[model samples]
Each structure stands twice: as C-alpha cells, then as structure tokens.
Target: MSDVFSGVYEINSPDVVSEYFEDQAVILNLATGHYYSLGGIAGSLWGLLIGGHATDAILENLAAQQPQLVEGASAFVAELISFGLIRQARAGAPGMSIDVAWTSEAPKLEVFEDLAELIAADPVHDVDLEAGWPVLRPQS
Candidate 1:
C-alpha cells in the first residue's frame, strides 16, 4: 500500500489544467488562470499535495523512494508553504491543504483521480523512478 506521502497527487477536479514543463519534466498547474511551477524535488512534493497521502507518510515515502532528496525535503516543503500552494490542513488533520483554485463548482472525487493519472503519465520531462530526482533544466 502507498504511504501517506507517497508523492501521489490528485487534482482538485473543480478547476485547473496542468501540464509538464517543456525544458524539464516538472509539472505545472494553472489554477484560477495562475501558473504554478513545480520542478525537481518540488515536483514530487506537489504530487503529494493532491491529497492521497498523509504528510508524514508522504515524507516517509519520499525517504524510501528518493533518499537523496530527503535532505532537501524540509526546505522544499517550506517553500511550497510560503507560496500558498500548500497549507496546513486543519487544526487536527495530519495533512496539508492543496489550493486547487477551482473557479467553478467542485468536481467529484473520481475526476480528481483521473486528473492525477493524466498528470503522472505526462511528466514535463522524462522521469526514471529508480533514479534520484531529475536535474531541473532551465526553462526555454
């Protein structure tokens, strides 16, 4: 079974269209017509924001899947928090909030899953799961 922080992201389903970066495999989400870039270690971190994994579990999964990036995880996470892309879930939740920035009404849960699958399949740059994080190239 996947852990809380398995880097598995889902979409808000309510509003947003995401695409992979051209120069790098990093993913970018355009929410409320705003662009959010998620690359290198942050790309994986963004994946978790979609809501499948718990914060701690996602961290644990990151450690197991990409040990090298583990050292940078905290800092990367901090940046995400600062960007308002991610926020504390609630007073007592074990997860963070992912601002999907839906302009319209919220979508059904299944739609989010579908979006996740699409994003996973179409990374901005090529990815090798067994390898460490991909080097984020300059955007063209």
Candidate 2:
C-alpha cells in the first residue's frame, strides 16, 4: 500500500435496530446518536476507512478498487470528516489518520440511520448493500 493506504477503521451497526440489510456502508455513532451512509464512491471510501487504512492509503486503495472514484476521494474524505464520521488521531503525528469504530449503544447513531435510508432507497438494490446491512445478517 502507498502512503495513502495504511491504517484501519471498523464499521459498526446497531444491535437493536432491525430495518436494513448487510453490506450497506452504514455506521452508527454511539456518542452522538447519528447515522451515516456512504453510497457509490463515498461508500467505497467509507469501506477503506473502516478497514483501518490511513487517509492517503484509503485514497490509493480506492483508486485501484474504484478508478472512477479516485478523483473524488480527497473531497469525499473531507466531507466525511465534516459529517463527523471520522476524526484525526493526534495533533502532529506523521501519517496521522482517522479511525472508525463500530458501536451498538443508543447514543451513537451517526452512520446507522443514514445507511438505513440508503439501503431502502438504493436504486440498483445492489447485493453489496445486502451484505453490509447489519440488521439483515443472522445473529451470532
């Protein structure tokens, strides 16, 4: 992986909610009770983030997995930050990257709701969304 492709992030889904499918780029934030979903190119970038990949590494990986989205990775990442889906680690760490973790608490709801809406409205009804939706998956 390149400088842009090193780090890891995890996507979390709600344990109580049950309205969406798996494979959707939906995440919930227990701290803020917010929901977020990354569809299309944004979805890919979100995946990279959850994988614990650094921002740069995310861009590089996305460039390869989704060439058409390479150009938009930077902006998309910025948007994700603005949306509070991700955050930087330390203030001055080299290769400092954002980390995404999954939560099942009530307070955290940033990514879950957004992802649910996306899954319900997916025009293509992509199977990937089915795999990502935590609600649709069998309980462990």
Instruction: Output the number of the lDDT-best candidate.
Output: 2
lDDT at residue 69 of model 2 (Cα atoms): 53
For 28-136, candidate 1 gives per-residue lDDT tens digits of: 3334233455545455455555445455565566656555555466555554544344544433335554432222221111112334433443245544445534423
Candidate 2, residue 109: the lDDT equals: 24
Candidate 2 Cα misplacement greater than 4 A, ranges: 1-20, 30-32, 90-140
Angstrom error at residue 102, model 2: 23
Runs of candidate 1 with Cα error greater than 4 angstroms are 1-34, 91-140
Q: State in Å the error of residue 106, model 1.
A: 33
Q: How well is each residue in 23-122 modelled by candidate 2, as lDDT tens digits?
A: 4555555445455654554554565555455566655545554555554556566555565556554322346453423222111123445445444433
Candidate maximizing TM-score: 2
